[model samples]
Target chain A: MRAPALIVENLRLKLCADRGDTTLLSDVSFEIQSGEIFGLVGESGSGKTLTALAIMRLLPPTIKATGKVIFDGVDLLALPEYQMRSLRGNRIGMVFQEPVAALNPTFTIGTQLICAVRAHHKLSGHKARERAIELLDMVGIPEPRSRLGFYPHQFSGGMCQRVMIAMALAGDARLLLADEPTTSLDVTTQDEIVRLLERLSKDHGISVLFISHDLGLVARLCHRIAVAYAGELVEVGHTDALLQTPLHPYTRGLVRCVPDLTQIGVLRGGIPGTPPMPGHWPGGCRFQQRCPLAGNGCDDAQVTSSLADRTVRCWKSAASVDTASIENTTSPTNGPKNLARNTTS
Target chain B: MAAASVSSIWSVVLHRLMAVIPTVLFGTILIFGLVQIIPGGAAEEAAGPEASAEAIAVLREEMGLNRPLHVQYLSWLGNAIRGDLGRSLTDRRNIAKAITERLPLTIELTVIALILSLLIGIPLGVLSAINRHNRIDAAVTSVSGLGLALPEFWLAMLAVNLFALKLGWFPATGVPSVELGWHEHIQSLVLPSLTLASGAAAAITRFTRSGMLEALSSSYIRTAWALGLSPAQIFFRFALKNALIPLVTVIGIITSSLFGGAVLVESVFVIPGLGTMLVTAVLQKDYPTVQSVALVLTVVFVMISLVVDIGCAVLDPRTRR
Candidate 1:
């Protein structure tokens, strides 16, 4: 088995406000194998980004996190901030959603990239700059040396994302936390960025925790996928297996939401209800309000139930297989249900 | 790349300099126009109230008050452009010479006050922002509020009483001669300059605190943190630099306004700076000197703003374009 690059166990986040503490994320646990791309898919406000921030120990002062984030057998959560600094960017690099905003506007790409290189490497400015240029070229930034002095505003969204990726890899980071790295780009650029990330992960043997709201896009890149609903992971399995026969109701709903160009005149209604606000989730299953398979047993939730090769949180996972008629009555609509249906045969 | 940026900087400076011309013109005209509307007759004030009507008329003619307003303005502007501000109507002393003698002292006081405010304000602001909503933030915020509210003259007097009289840590009045040595000169100016700085420092603290708070919350600062930069590096290299763009405007405003505040402080301390000279000129109805000093102060204010714009362009590359 490939060595585990990062493992998070029972991660919980709470916002300690004057009113009271609001539980933001509870019991978020996942593992990423070396060189594997693990997708954490969820809607906005579902705490996917929060998970990444928690891992990095970058949450705001008011928000508190308690959990073990073991990286390379060392518990990151237990480490002092000074030790964490040594590991962050050097071992665990991050790429934010907004590429333009992620970079300091006052500095040039060369300066920013060189700073990252020097942070952990203890290199001279010239050496750091050379390495920065090398990294830019590796990320497909043309004429890297010439573009070094260009500011973030001078670069396009796609180029900025590429620069951000290069900077993330500047310290030879073993694991990359990419928080919707391509969310701001167009479809064509998003595909290019996905391909680049996939290639980089394969070549460098770097593990990546890719967080995104789009299942289709995540499926194109991630090796394993975890579905988050209201700050809790409801399902985790191989990407194709999860997409084809999603065990959790929330995962199935997400799979069904992916756009299908083959199905004409079929209007896809997105997940019916908005995700519950933090501190307002139902006592049992957080997704119960929107789950089509929600039933009596769902009132009392169970921790993830391990099936043959998947972990699903839903109480109705076993009954869901026999309830084929219920799934059909909801109207398949526009979906890559074709892809899953094709896989079924 | 250096050559290109240098040329671009020059172009920006050129463009800014072009913009300043109109502002300077407007400022000069406004000063000249406003002095014209003052209630007292400069000739009568200069000749004395008992002077005969003929003598008053002769003085008015000599002073060019009988000339067309525009003609008078143009001649004054022409003389100003040539650095000849004309003699004071009251004492017949050369206004330009008087200003030349006093300008450096005023500039020194204002500069010291500005430097003091920046050194005090920026660090306190950063500290306040970093400890936002905590006791330190509250203390700094409330003290700055008091600084902003208290009148400058009252603060000056209080400072003089405490430091000069009670504590005997500083002199109460008059700047030291250069022969007294640089340290003594600086020391003697401390009370007046500190009093002048109090309000500006308070304003700057507020602006810098808010600017830094916003900058600290920015995604870039988060990126800096993620990049494993030390807290000091993240604060000074990233957050403070980002905050400085907006802070520059507030500083520019404070620097310009300090010249005005210096007028009162200089009078209280008897520093013999431009402010004191301006006060003397105004009290004696020395119109040429008053007009010249106003013009000089306005020009200084305009120049400070221009420098601020250029500084912003340097700090934020996007503004360079």
Candidate 2:
């Protein structure tokens, strides 16, 4: 396996408000290997984006992050702000959700790209312009030299996303924190962006922490998948293993919810109930309220236990060696009633 | 590409310039109609109460008031377009020549006042917005609030009383001719321009503060911060440019109002300006001079608004659409 490029250990984030402090993320630990695209899959408000922000130390003033985000053997949480600023675009780049809004409307694309290029490198203005054109071409923009003078409004949404990608890559960063980069794009553009990111990772050996709400897309792009429920990662494993037999009930619900092509004309199903809001999460297991196979044991504190190929955070999965039987009992045919009966007996 | 954009800007300028014709035409009719509705006829007013009926008839014929109202308006408009505003009834001086001399004074006063407003207001607003909700912000906000509430005429009178009458620092009346030297000329402008600028400065301060606050929270600003740009670059280059877009319109409105306020300000100071000329012309029933002055003021207002549109387009390309 490649060396871990980013290691986040026990990253806890809390929102300090006039009312009280609300824990937004708690005890979130994960490691991204070099050149790997690790998918962070969850519904909205599940702290997926917050995790990325916390790692980058970009949380707003009221939010407090306390944990060790170790990169290159140094704890980033303890780094001085000036040092962090230097590391931001030079070593780690970020791409935002809204492509068009992410660019300054008044500045030409060339000026913006040249600014990004000259930020980290000591290049002359002419050289920077050439580099910017090359970077635009690298991102597959047609007629890069001519399009440099165009403003953000002149470009379509997909083209704007490509420009945003080019700016992110202009810094020659090793790790990219992409937070729902394709969420605002159409399906065809989404596919193209996904493929572009895949090729970038393959060519440049850049590690990506791809955060999204679409399970099917994440499974398709990510080498490994971590499913977060509420504010905690409920299960994490290889993409194929997690897709085949999701050990945590929340992960299973996510996998089952992916829209199927053969099931056209049938109303696609979604996991019942919404994720709990920050500061209101139930004690013990956060997902017990929504889990189909939740039993009396789930009311106790959930523990992350390592299995042969993955880690499961459910008490039922940790206690049983026969995960296949547990999975079979929780199938749609058996449903929650049968699983609850089996757990009691 | 540069040529294309330049040509497009010229086309926009031409279109805007064309739109001004109907506005000016309407303004002329309105000015002519308004002076026509006054209590006494201009011919009788010009001839005086003791004048005989023959004298009034001769005056009416000479001034073209004996013709129908439309014929009188049309003839006046024709002469006005040819740069001849006719002779003033009271003094018999050429109205256009009188205007050329006085209009410069009013334009200078308004320009100085506008510059003072922008210089004083923009920095204070940026400071307040940067330190938002703090002691400094509250202090600036309250002070500008006080400035806005004070009437310009009262302020002008008070300034004249204190600075001119009591302090003996400035002369209260009569602008010095340029031949008197720049020092005395600028000294003469001090009290009147300050009074005219106070309210507009306050208004600009409020608008700039709100606009800067809105721009500071925009998504592009967040992206700039994430890009690791310096604080100076972020605030000055990114935030200020966006903030200036909305402030341009506010500045335009303040400029037009400054011209309006100059009338009161000029009267209080007894300065030789278009405003003073307008007030005297109205009182003496000088309809030719009144129509020309009012038309000039309207055209100025329309042109200022046109500049505001082009300024916004230049600052924000999205508005160009």
Candidate 3:
């Protein structure tokens, strides 16, 4: 079997402030296989985005990061600044959330795209221009050559996003990191972008580490999902298994919060409280305060367990309860009895 | 496309002219009113105190001060429209002729001062922004602050005392007249130009430093760096271009101030420029000469501001709308 494309091992990050140091990420680890889409789902400030920044070494100067981000057998965190810069647009690419603001407003779309292409490779001006037109065409831009001189402000939001995707693909990168790429778009544009990204990933065989708070969308795109809460990974498993039965309470609450269009009168309930602050995370399970299944042992300083292929950091998942009955309570209200029947089946 | 470009240029010029009309009118009215109100009219000075009242009356009639205020203004305005600026009371020569002879020297000095300011200020600003909060930034800030505080006349005196008298490298006074060779003429201007440029350099350096610091923190600069562009590319293509909008506005203001500062520097260096002419007119109360020169400076300032505005619109597309 081929080695995993990317491996993040025991990554930890601390932000140094005037008051004191606050831990942002704690011992997070995951792996992405070739051509696989790995989803990291968390609420805002749960260290999901920080993990991406750490992998890219794009964190602010004051933060202290310690970990091993090994990609194709090379440790990214250990490379010098110059070598890391060389590898940034060549080996790895990133897509930010705000498509409109991500591009330089002063430059033409062609110039912006050509800059990215020439940044990693040397080519004559004519060849680079031809390549830029080809990339824009590939991203479904109409009249690529005619539109070459148009500035970013002239393009609509959806078209700007297409231009951004073309820029990200300029250097033929192997690993793509997309941080909430569709979060700022409208629903129609969001669907269109998702379809485009899916096609690109399939056609190019690019491994993607997709970060988002929209678990429903991630469920459709990602092969494997890691649920993070309060800077710690609370659970990790196959997408289908985790969606069908989330062992961690935080994951279950998140799945329950997805709006159901079929049930119009009933409002979906969200997680009761916000994610814990950085330095003030509760002992034992960080979700104990919000977890509906909290018990005496939930407050124990150390808790860990495994259920088949899923790893969960909850004391309750290991309890002696009727799994079938509990699984039914967590299912979406639309298909109430299906959960009951799946456990027995 | 040609039509579009022509229309756009036309619209830009129209808009700039409209914006400056009020300023031009206000400046002209204030200068004319101030010169008229000053005691000891040009006629009184021309006809000495020893002259009889009848002789003074004859001098006033010839000078056109015997007419009503409105008539006097219209006559002067008509002469200005025809490119005739009347005659100077002291020298009995054409005011326009006197201005043409002196204006070039002042303009040359101002241009040299502007070049010096840009050359020294922009680099110091870039360095200060790059090394923010370091020893170099602190030193530059403090030295520029001191330069601003020192009076221009005092600074000129000190420069002459040090470079011209003590070192014997340059002449202490007496500007090289037009009879001198071009090279000697320029050399004579060096000390005076430096004296005026030092103050402008100080102001520009402070402005550039602050503008660059703001641009460095902008998101676009960060985006440029993330795209794997080198530091030099990021500095020139992203940060510096954005920083120029603010710097350009400061340059316009500095250009206007140069007219006023040129007066003192011109006197100290003894160059026969408009500054010396204005000083002489004020002492002798030669109303026509002072009013004409003041009107010309106001017009020049309005034109410069219009040029700066159009330049900004071209450089930044967002401003065009």
TM values, all candidates: 0.95, 0.95, 0.90
- What tens-digit string does per-residue lDDT give for candidate 2 at A93-174? 8888989998998888898888888878889999999999998998899999999988899998889988888888888788
Comparison by lDDT, 1 against 3, better one: 1
Number of the top candidate by DockQ? 1
Candidate 2 Cα misplacement greater than 4 A, ranges: A321-333, A336-345
Cα lDDT of model 3 by residue, B1-321, tens digit? 234434666678788899897888788678878888887777788887798889999988987788998888777777886889988877888999899898888888888888888888888878787778889999999888987899889999999999999998888776786587877887788898888888888988888888888877765555566567777777777688778888888898998888889999989988788898999887777778999899888888898899888877665555654
Clashing residue pairs for model 1? none
- What RMSD, rounded to one decimal, does every model reach? 3.6, 3.1, 4.5
What value of lDDT does candidate 2 attain over all alpha carbons? Answer: 0.87
Candidate 1, residues A63-181, lDDT tens digits: the string is: 99998999989988889999999888889999999999999999998999998899899898889889999999999999999999898999999999999899888886999999999
Q: A1-345 in candidate 3: lDDT tens per residue?
A: 657889998899999999999999888888888888889999999998889878888888778889899998999989998988877766787777778887776667887888888988898899999999998898889999977777778788888888888887788678888888889999888888877888788899888888999998888889999999998888888999888887777888788777788999766666666788999898788888776667788777644555555667776664412253447545545432333343344
Q: Which candidate number has the best lDDT?
A: 1
Tell me the number of clashing residue pairs for each predicted model: 0, 0, 0
Model 2, residue pairs in steric clash: none
Give the clash total for candidate 2: 0
lDDT of 1 at A96: 95
Q: Rate the local accuracy (lDDT) of all candidates.
A: 0.89, 0.87, 0.81
Candidates ranked, most accurate by DockQ first = 1, 2, 3
